[model samples]
Target: MISLANSAARRSLRTVSQVRTLSSGIDIDVDHYSSGWNIDDIGEFTAKTGKYQIKTFNKISEKGLARFNPEKFEIMGSDWDSTNANAILLRSHKLQESEIDVSVRAIARCGAGTNNVPVARCSELGIPVFNTPGANANAVKELVLCGMLLGSRRIVDGVNHMKDLGAQGLAKERVEKDKSMFGGQEIKGKTLAVIGLGHIGASTARDAAALGMDIVGYDPGLSIDSALKLPNEIDLTDSIASAVANADYISINIPYIKGENGTHGIIGKNVISSFKPNAVLLNFARGELVDSEAMKEFLDNGDGRYVSDFPDDLLWDHKNAVILPHLGASTEEAEDAAAAMAADTISDYLQTGTIVNSVNFPAVSLPARPDGAIRMSVINKNQPGVLASITDVFAKAKLNIVQQINQSRGDVAYNVLDIDPTANHEAISMKDLQKELTMTDGVLSSRVVFGTPGCGYARNIDGQYWV
Candidate 1:
């Protein structure tokens, strides 16, 4: 087995030398060669052998699709069978667990929320689900401002009334007399309670403060970075009740996770009952985060208004409810940003095993591979000795480790190892190494990426090559 491995390694090294000689003139300086090589070079080389198959669902922005180099990827439309896809990029398409095939390495949602995708199932399969958080934050924040104005000023009502009067040919006289009916308080001095101090919430709070609205924020899970972005004058509260108790306007910008302990139906009777009289409630977030029944009762009992980007059957015709067609992130700029972010994220992961902004996986990034090194990525259940066992495989094969990075999130762990063979050591068979790693207990999947020219990439799943 060792002799056969050495023969294959020698052949691979010869192919690498031949390709380099053909691409660049002989006697190239090592420093210049090292400086010039980049991820794009690997991508272009891989393109000649096999391009990564990317399946896109829904209408991804052209700007985002263009981020994928046509030389390195074959982008498929929604009609294509996703069974052989190396990755998926989507926007709001409801993806099922069954649709995730063995060939899939990652899933990138163009927008913030992964509610439309089966995240937990993908996590269990060792798949990192990427979300473009804050990519659409500005868009949603602008719409929240619109919702607040629409709720406070009764602009929709006035417009409808004006249309009716115009049809009756009495617009001039009636407009002056009835304009007072649409009169409402300005948001200048009103207090706003912002729930979930994430990207959108923080952006909303900063803008609202600039508009002279006092801000009260509630987010128990607020990170240091998010808190730093908040306005200094904004008040931070520990609980939802205290935040909305005295505020005239409340906005929910949290994610919707669907479990008893999750954010599903988070806004219930207790929170609604504590709302100040005539308060405006805005939910530009997921509809499921608020209890429809509780919101309906709140609307029925008071002069308060409900404004939402998502439409609900219960509040569809409510006199005090203003529902939009989920247009929070509908702007062209937001779409382009989100699609581009997703494309870049997936590309980075596929080419270099760098993960950022992943919802289910820990953020892990390693420096560029050393010259003539092979990169190996392993996904496994987060358990004791998994890392040790992985290193043991390399030790037995006598592969010199150049660099490594490992991170765990929840039940899964991701490992990336860079291996370079020394002059005295023989190269281990990459296929055998992948088989051994995947066969190891607790391992979910394993992939080997060759930095050596002409070798391309291979993964244990489906035993297919992805250049």
Candidate 2:
């Protein structure tokens, strides 16, 4: 009457495969996608699925695939798009409704634009999330350089003028001639002020250093040691105004954001006016870092020219400006590179379950302990005496804590505790812990990870994690 033996075995294997952490640091999921996604393999993921995906652009709809099956596999690269946003919310909603074990990989996160994927939701679900930082450093660097050159040389404008006006000595020469009317200043000997020199800023600095331009980056967070290593000693400034003042061109590379925005505009009319009148502005970074209204006003006054990859909606009444539709890193090569980084990040995560660049999740990698530790990730409401009470419960169970990492993501607090299950009065598996933790008043949920590729967990401002 009961047909649950072999079917259940097959289902379980399909749902959750047994994974063992090996010496190579690859965490092989028993229920993995396929053998093609090997732990050590990087080029294959790109060579097979990604090349066409990135080149064709929107041909392979990972967004649709994610919507249909939220728990099937990790989404490694979701920077923007309406579909991506919906898919992100869909995944979060699914995770919040039940106890879900998940992994995520997001690269080029928090650089610019506020249309981020559902990062906050991952934290709430206790879903272990990972991201790759500085994966697009080269692309971003080249973008900055290109924007600066385009703005300074007025290449686009000069070309437009040539077409509009007839060329030659009689005609053709005239076209090539009088180009200096819009021809701009040479980049050499001009000073450049860079803001927020992480990976992008550092690369931009090296390129600018080769151009014989004096470099001064403004960031309260940067170290003097990092400044000194950039071929030439980049004069460092602590204040934003100090970086902008007197500089021929100001290139912003800050990862700043505001107003529920991780990467929105930071430069306003005030910041715009701070630079010298003839100074050009280049923003291939995050769009929100520059205020559209201020930019419109600045352009109206002919104070400067602005060149950016920001979308049209990001622009106000602007003139003397070139907007490239937020395509700073939209190159084919950049796509392949980003895809490889993202795929590898997800691949590593699906197996051994490590987080290299987690935006919402904690950065710690909870490796399996040699002493056979059972790790418990407990999510509970933010209030008093919850931790103590939970400790009492564990103490009553005669459990000994090995290593614990606790952090509060907004109102909810998460505790990742590694305990020796043998130290308990009796052995307690994840099922027992889950049931017990769920019944507790403040505990949203508790999970026991076998140290398979888990995100460690992700977080957001929403109250969904409490459910």
Give the top-scoring candidate (TM-score). Answer: 1
Q: Going through the candidates in order, what is the number of backbone clashes in each?
A: 0, 29
Q: Model 2, 269: alpha-carbon shift in Å?
A: 2.7
Candidate 1, run of 10 with poorest lDDT? 29-38
Ten residues in sequence with the least summed lDDT for candidate 2: 47-56
Q: Report clash pairs, candidate 1.
A: none
| TM-score against native, each model | 0.86, 0.67
Q: Local error of candidate 1 at 37, Å? A: 34
After best superposition, candidate 1 residue 148: deviation in angstroms?
1.0
Q: What is residue 132's positional error in candidate 1, in angstroms?
A: 0.3
* Candidate 1: stretches off by over 4 Å: 1-49, 451-467
List, residue by residue over 68-138, the lDDT tens digit for candidate 1.
Answer: 98878889886763334678898988997656644578999999988888888887778899999999999
Per-residue CA lDDT of model 2 for 104-202, tens digit only, reads 222222122223444455444444344345655788788888888887877887776776665432446565467657767789999988887766787
